[model samples]
Target: MRSAVVVPETPVKSLFAYPLLLSLLVGGPALAQTATRDPAQIQAGTYAVDPGHTQVGWRVSHFGFSHYSGGFSGVSGTLDLDPKNPAAAKLSIRIPVGSVSTTSAKLTGELKGEQWLDEAKYPEMTFVSTKVEPVGADKAKVTGDLTLHGVTKPVTLDVTLVGAGVNPLNKKVTVGFEATGVLKRSAYGVKTYVPLIGDDLQLTIDGAFERRD
Candidate 1:
């Protein structure tokens, strides 16, 4: 006698299961509420710099061979903003010169030495905005007094609003920006290499500020 064979049952699949998993992995709805670039969404008040997320990057030509890059962290600052009057916005930031870093340990250490940044003499670099001119819907020209290596010079940063919204993890109102500018190292008394390492330093700043008010 042949025994009856039992058929294995096929498991049912929920149509919503795959989409739910994908949404969570790719940050669907949660990401939408966290950030926005619309200037109208920004709240008017004071915002303190989120140092952990802010950085000032520098790049310069290396003996006409390649461009070398480095960055300075441990930034602190504040932003006083009014969406209705972006031209009147105020900005002030301080960056620890000793925080400068590069891929090469020796190069990084040399940058902090007397002939370079002279971090011992100038512990910090500072910028205070003297004028904020709105150039576009989300762009501006921020002219500030940049003090580096004990010398102060007027530096204009072409700034753009990156985003403004509530930070998902910290639940704090946050705003971000990117700025680019160029300055001659000689102007700041950092003329060690001169034309060999490129006198002009290209600066790029990624700044994050959290609402304090």
Candidate 2:
């Protein structure tokens, strides 16, 4: 006669715990995904600008009564960065002049005409950084040549590192920055109405860059 074989049964609590533990292990990184402003976390490499996530905004005083604002899209750029040597960073940016948009349709059309930006003559505006001076752990002064409206001028942008991290959706390393500068419209030969439309233009750039590899 042969004895009956017996099988050990799994504990009820362990059965529920197994799947829960597996889920935590698999989703831990996604659950903890976040961008940080720490300069030490910046990765050293070449990054291409994320045009869909970058924008350039400009504001000017309208007849000294109120501020008028507009923005440019379709921005493209590249950045070579080294966290250990921030000063050695290089940047290049391109902006399509025709992408300028404002609240009013008529005003937007006028901005693209010969009287204002004259996009027909100068189809693109570009900036190439000449120097990068770190001011703080996450701040820098970037001096570059800004070519706009058929003219080029030296402009200094106060740039702040906003965040650096791996993008959740694409899993690519990404960095973000905010830059501000003031430029005289007349200096770039975009002067249609000097004092009337405000000669000084306040520029704010929101840039996002993703690592190439």
Q: Which stretches of candidate 2 lie over 4 Å from their true place?
A: 1-31
**Could you say which candidate leads in lDDT?**
2
Relative to the true structure, candidate 2 reaches a TM of 0.85
Worst 10 residues of 1 by lDDT: 8-17
**Residue 201, model 1, lDDT:** 97
lDDT of 1 by residue, 1-213 (tens): 999999987445653558776688678765446789999889999999999999899999999999999999999989999999998899999999999999999999999999999999899999999999998889999999999999999999999999999998888999999999999999888988789999999999999999995
Candidate 1 CA-lDDT value:
0.93
Expressed as tens digits, the lDDT of each residue in 159-201 for candidate 2 is 9999999988888899999999999999988888889999999
Strongest candidate by TM-score = 1
Model 1: how large is the Cα RMSD against the reference?
Answer: 6.0
